[model samples]
Target: MRLPKTAHTSRPWRIHEIAGDFQVEDVWALPTPGGPDDLAHLVDQFAQGKGEPIDSPVARALFAIRWKLGALFGWDKPDGGVGGRLTSLRGRLPADLREGPKGPDLTAAPFTSVFQTHDEWAAEMGNRTVHGVMHIGWVPDGAGGYRGQMAVLVKPNGRLGALYMLGIKPFRYLGVYPALIREIGSEWRARAGQRAAGSAGAAGAGG
Candidate 1:
């Protein structure tokens, strides 16, 4: 569910310190509800490319068109990515965050993990369009449990980046984000079921 901007901005997230210059592009109430410790699990699943793929046929078509357009326009080349045309936020991390666990290594995803604290995890990605941060936070649901919240922060590169962001805004909100959220919810339910089955097996063995 798309959340109000204040859902992220009103909080005391560490991301606010470093990403002051970036715009809060989107905030969403993730469907992965669980205990506090499950934040890391969610982060791991994301880093491993578990639910990031575009599953909807329309979304997949859009992705295909976008990638083709990127290739034609040299939008996703190495020269347009982090450490080339753009700088990584890792260079701006304080000493403590720099030396701490930088979360998991991504294999097939565009994002690379930045930092993983107790209740938060962040990853970063950059392309010709924009340099963006994906932040996952664990927030209490007032029922003695917690749920996941996600915020997208982006610093658009230049005129091209700004235009690109504007172009994709509608597709993202209507097609891509919805598909991705549904996939994440499905994966979370599957994982929860597996854990329950494992626990039941152990209990039966003990009995």
Candidate 2:
């Protein structure tokens, strides 16, 4: 993915993809290692124990949500894209794609796959290609404060890809992200729990 380097703590997020839907839960990194196996494992596990398709409505909904995410967060351009018709948006997307039904190929394939797939997505959108770059954020360890975390990504024009790499694993559904946020916030508040009491006693005795 070769994302632009930014302060890890800049754009943060808690993973909210899967938990009850699947396993292999963990934070996602840009350009994840061992592309093929890592990706195939997701679909493989989805069918384990039960059967193909996993028999999970939530999983299906999650997939469908990320598959076509334009409805979640509004697009960049309000008028819609070209001449303010259907393909009119605020910014342009990555290059190489041009035409309708051509959207970001969240497929585990190489960048070329994304280009080819989005070409069709553009065509379907009245020949107006998208304009944006791959966006992913990370959490950096903060000094004198709790640790940090971040969002998997912000798709082009908020258009989520077909394969949600985050959902490949489960545990995220239990609200891992929300928990993280609360944890961090608690750390910043008045420490009144046993741990804080222990710390105070230790400091008093110079231990």
Candidate 3:
């Protein structure tokens, strides 16, 4: 579900430190709910799964079209990405975060892991239009269990970036995000079902 910006800004997230130049583009409550330690499952699935739930047919087609246009326009060249046209946020990490788990390696994905803790994970992706951060935090639902909260932060490249963001606003809000949320919910439930089945099997063995 879409959430107010405060849902993210109110928290003392490490992202706040580096993303001051970026804006909170969107925030949503992820469907994944579990104990604090279970956050790893969500992060791992996102990082390792080759075909993520967010990559539905329409989304994939949109992305393919975008990439083709990017290639044609020189928008996605290496120089326009991390460590070339843009510097990575990793350089700004404090010593502790630098030394700690830098989340998952996502060579196969568009994003690169920035940092992670028991309750939080962040990754970054960029092209000519924008440098964006995807942050997930395990937040208390006020009923004792924890659910994931996702926030997107972006630093636009220039006037082009601003215009690009404006152009995609409708599609992002109306289609992409909602589909992604449903996918996350499906994956979350699937994991829960697997755990329940395993537990049932264990109980039968004990009996």
Cα RMSD of all models vs. native, in order, equals: 2.9, 18.2, 3.3
lDDT of 3 at 16: 86
lDDT of 2 by residue, 1-207 (tens): 112324322232111121111121123232212212122222212113122122345554554664355445543244554345432221233332223223332332111111112001111121122322221222223332222222232222222322333443353444333343343334324223544575568789996
* Candidate 2 lDDT trough over 10 residues, lowest sum: 118-127
Query: Could you give candidate 1's per-residue lDDT for residues 1-207 as a string of tens digits?
Result: 999989999999878877789999999988988877778778866866644365799888888899999999988999888888878888888888889989985665688887888898888888888999999999997788898999999999889889999999999988899998888888788789765686679789999
Of candidate 3, the 10-residue stretch with the lowest lDDT total is 47-56
Ranking by TM-score: 1, 3, 2
Candidate 3 per-residue C-alpha lDDT over 52-161 given as tens digits, one digit per residue, 9 for 90 to 100? 44647777666777778888889888888888888999998889888999988665568999999888899998889999999999899888998999999999999999
Query: How does model 2 fare in lDDT?
Result: 0.29
RMSD of 2: 18.2
Of 2 and 3, the candidate ranking higher by lDDT? 3
Q: What's the true lDDT of residue 46 in model 3?
A: 80
lDDT score of residue 7 within candidate 1: 95
What's the distance in Å from true for residue 122, model 3? 0.9
- Deviating ranges (above 4 Å) for candidate 2: 1-5, 9-176, 183-191
Off by over 4 Å in 1: 50-52, 194-207
Count of backbone clashes, every candidate in sequence = 0, 37, 0
Question: lDDT at 10 for candidate 1?
Answer: 94
Better of 1 and 3 by TM-score: 1
